[model samples]
Target: MSDPHYDREAEKYESPIPSREHILSFIQEKPRSKRQLFDLLALADEQKKAFERRLRAMVRDKQLSCNKSGVYRPFSNRGLLTGTVIANPKGFGFVALDKGGKDLRLTSQQMKLVFHGDKIRVRLLNKKLDAEIVEVLETVKTLVGRLHLDGKKPYVVVDDRRIKHNIEITELIDGCLDNQVVVVEMLSSPTIDSDAKGKISSIIGNYLDEGVEVDSAIYRHQIPAVFSEKALKESAQLPTKVIPKDKKNRIDITKLELITIDGEDSRDFDDAVYAEPTKNGWKLLVAIADVSHYVKEGSELDSESHERGNSVYFPHRVVPMLPEAISNGLCSLNPKVERLSMVCEMYIDPLGELLDYKFYSAVMLSHARLTYTQVNEMLEDKKSPLRMTFSNVTDNIDFLYGLYKTLRISRQKRGVMDFDRIESQILFDNKGKIKDIVASSRNDAHRLIEECMLMANQAAAKFLQKNNEDFLYRSHPKPTAEKVELTQKFLTAIGLTLEGGIEPESRNFAKVLKQAKGRDDENIIKTVVLRTMKQATYTPVNEGHFGLAFEDYAHFTSPIRRYPDLLVHRAIKRVLNTTSREPSGKMIEFGTHLSMTERRADDASRDVEQWLKCEYMRDKVGENFHGVISGVAGFGLFVELSEVYVEGLVSIRDLKDDYFIFDDVHHQLKGQRGGKIYRLGDMIKVKVASVNLDDRKIDFIPDFG
Candidate 1:
């Protein structure tokens, strides 16, 4: 083919070769080696040097790509793509494309060359978009798993069930035994002919050892659970109590009846609340620990805090972002002690609309430390004896309760999402054995504090946004079109209607949940509706929070446990002072890191909870319980026990008498011959058949007999 821009190239260079456009066109038809391209283009020997230079430039510019064998091809989407591999234990995977679109499926055979979370280049195999791994760009260095000896040779079953390959143990450390949880360092990557090989780096513990679940989860999720030497030293150097200098140049709100309300077992108090009736409506003050004041920017302590991002709360343990001295001591708003804090004071009308707000550094003394239950008891009954005990703050609590009701009304009017999801808390006996898993219910007191924090966070966002300053905002985007369509189809299949036409608001979701109330499949409808929403994230750019129905929002509470709140405190300080230095770091990158850390903490917590739940079910085999089908997959139906809240899979193979076909859109399985159907949210009786501690899996079977 002739060069399309030959005249342009000729005018630009005396020794011009074929234009880039012409070269790309040629390679688009078929990849050509440098030698073949030189022969086909009929370039003179001297011109070959210039032609090679042109090819290099084209490759550099991403117009073309050169393979290892000197083969050049067009770098177009249809031919090749780069993405992260999302692996499945069922022996298949998908590529999450860098440029967002439908994920390309990788068959079991094609997945052998890569590990989960590996970034790789893939070539399109056919029209169905089946992809073959072209090159692995990155590999996960280490994995946490249980070691097992198959007769003589040893192998590891990865803790993350997504990775299906049993890695061969090339070297095992001394004292490591069979069925022990260990961390393995990869020695060789997987290939079509052989499995991955690794050496044991460290032994966590025996698979069933007490507290082994927490240890395994910490390692598996790569959560930084230990404090660094420098950070600890920094913490030690700080004074044990609030000093006079720390309170200097701060507004004194010590006389105000500010009280901290939290859970019964809570120790690290991050915020305190005070409220009074104002002429407009009400005056509310939310005082957060001034962590940025102590943990200076760029300090070792700050670095440690930023690395942890947020505290990880397990069943009985907490991986705190700050050291105990800061998180549980000086920064904590303990009762009857002077504490330095960053305060957000807001004035609102009777209708609960925020009218005006002010941010300032303050020195405050908490009058009382209250629990949610105590607050609820005091507010619910007029003659409650506890009211007299906390008389110093009961009036203040009443004022706060009034403000909470107003804010709740405002929130409802604003169309905020109210998901009535029940969270399970695992109870352990004195010896740390599983006792029971109970639902943690939220009451008005919880909502009061939540509303208070929401208002403060919203004020902080508005304060920074109005100043035109760059800061991280808690962003929750609207759901994608694809998810909405799927949810619509599911709702339609169930004879339900999502109110909003296409782009629904939070109110629309709330309406659906209300519609599903008391129905047999209410839980299923709630789960599906919840799944349609997008995950909230932290970003420098302000995208309004969809779930909270907030036009402006940032996390300004819990600086003691969250790094972003610390950043917000610093930003507020900078805006409040002309000489104060702004917080350091690229805001965009910081947001991304914090978001990932949040997810990491959640995953680690979930891992520990799953292990505990598996252990809880180990002794219940053969015991039948009533459950609701929570999830439907081609392989099985996941049932959540009614009272215990434990989930187990009822495999399709155990569903006797017929071959079942999975209906993905309807979320059900239909028997091909008998026409028997099992669906998500259908109530049924199931017996605990087996439990796999290593995999953290519980298996159940239908107990019709």
Candidate 2:
């Protein structure tokens, strides 16, 4: 018999918990594709019985579908697809194809000849868009995974859950111990079927090594740790520095009290913002390091950066977009360096209204390199010896702070919703252990920097707007009816009320949030309300950003790490400096693609980050921690621990004695017997139970008082 777990979900889709009937029928019913068989049997076993009877009846009635081959399929007779497999541990997965709406559902066993993360050919058993994966054309010969010895056999547990099964280590090449993640090479492939066999090729490192994140990020991102020969050859020839006379002119370095403010450990500084109170209002100079000036479009360096898409910054290390020579040296806006930059000069008034904004190309000298901690301390009147280091900007910092206040007021008036949540920064030890988790707050300096970046991005949006041009503008669609309705119900259950529904837009939501300020569940409210809004994405068709309440917005800062920003920088330069140059229609289209690609890279990066963070928190298992309910699910509640800022699943199964039902409308998990409710923004205590680093799942036992 097939594995019990496998057979359960593979059955007909009749169980409250999906079972294996559908998968088996799909595999057994050769005439019909898996999805078709599943959907057919899923309809009613009574009518689906007797294959000839069901087919004859369906054909006679013309209520069902089939092909001329008499082999029923989803799309066509074969219902096959070539795509990438995205796996979840639930034994089912989705296949992402290159074509539009290309995702199809496949079961664990139906994943024919493909391994997780492998590009493969799949055949749909049924005419369903989501069918079981029927084939995998190519398996990743080299993979990164954890080594776990089960009895006599050792298995490389894949970090990527998309791979349905653990790869057995036919040979432990380096005396690799259990629970250590290692690299593997595929030694066997299913000749006529889907399963892939592989061996542990090399021991990468211990699971929680300090450098593991960088290694994982590089592999997951497909980033080459070393530069290619072609890329290296190109970088070697590149000018180390712009010639003394090559610059347009010696731009004022001491005149403007420009500063770079970022995280404490930041190595690459991409932007500097300086704003001085002007006669009419304020003159804000947003200078972004000119990366395009060196990484010329279509060059080998450009091609490399494009392939990398963006720099991946892990806690311990960074996978740079360009080689270190460019990212950390020439292109970095390090203080005292005369780096090329594209500046957005904006004049604004006390009312937070922009009088005018213009994009300009220039070379800039960063007067000081500051960190958020330093700026925040100065703002809070904490003792700082380095206060003298930024003497020139001491008074200007005051001015910048005042401008951000005005911008905040202005932004509020414009209905922008600022979802300010406490983000946790994980500190690491030299050995790659999580030293401590620190709660990060948005301080005056952060706001000042953020306001400046927003201004530049909004200006980019307006630039194209005024030109009446079709360009890639980052947009977020309004919430859906179902999500909005669900959110409304949740708000009412928590005794919170909204004046208007989802139609009220960002300002309205901001007002509600402002009203909920300092409340215990404020973060929870913000998170869920955000869930109701559409995710922001790059598109030529502008729908505007509902979250920022911006009719126009584009990323015009941080070109060092983000491709979209570089593209936006190019567009801005073309508009500001190049009088005869026009952005080709093709160029705009490419930007859109790059923007989408960049978004995917960001998502992947975030997933990897979240996974590693969870892994780091594993050592603290069984320890009780304070957390807030971040989300509500049918099976459990999501608790984001206050101390670590790491989120874990608090399974309802372990929440006291009462049977719990998901009160989704309340955004909480409630006990049916006691009427105990755990809402989205509720404060709760939890003890960590199981930390499945393999699943990136942290199971918490909720403290139900």
Q: Provide C-alpha RMSD values for all models, in order.
A: 9.0, 8.5
Candidate 2 residue lDDT tens string, 565-618: 777776666665544244357655666557655665675567666776777777
lDDT of 1 at 674: 94
**Superposed model 1: Cα runs more than 4 Å off:** 1-83, 97-104, 121-129, 493-495, 579-585, 657-661, 670-676
lDDT of 1: 0.89
Candidate 2: C-alpha RMSD to true structure equals 8.5
Measured by lDDT, the strongest candidate is 1
Q: Candidate 1 residues 1-705, lDDT tens each?
A: 678798999999988889888887778889999998888889998899889888877864668866434678777556568999999878899999987798988888768778888998887655787776667888888899889985678999888877888789989899998899899999887866689999999999988888878888887777888999999999999988888888789999999999999999999998999999977899999999999889999999999899999999999889899999899998999999999999999999898899999999999999999999999998899899999899999989999999999998898788777776777888999988889998887989999999999999999999988876657999999998889888888999999888777788888887777788888888789898888899999998888999898889999999999899998888898888854444346997899899999999998998888889999999999999999999999998999998898999999999996899999889999999999999998998999999998778999999988
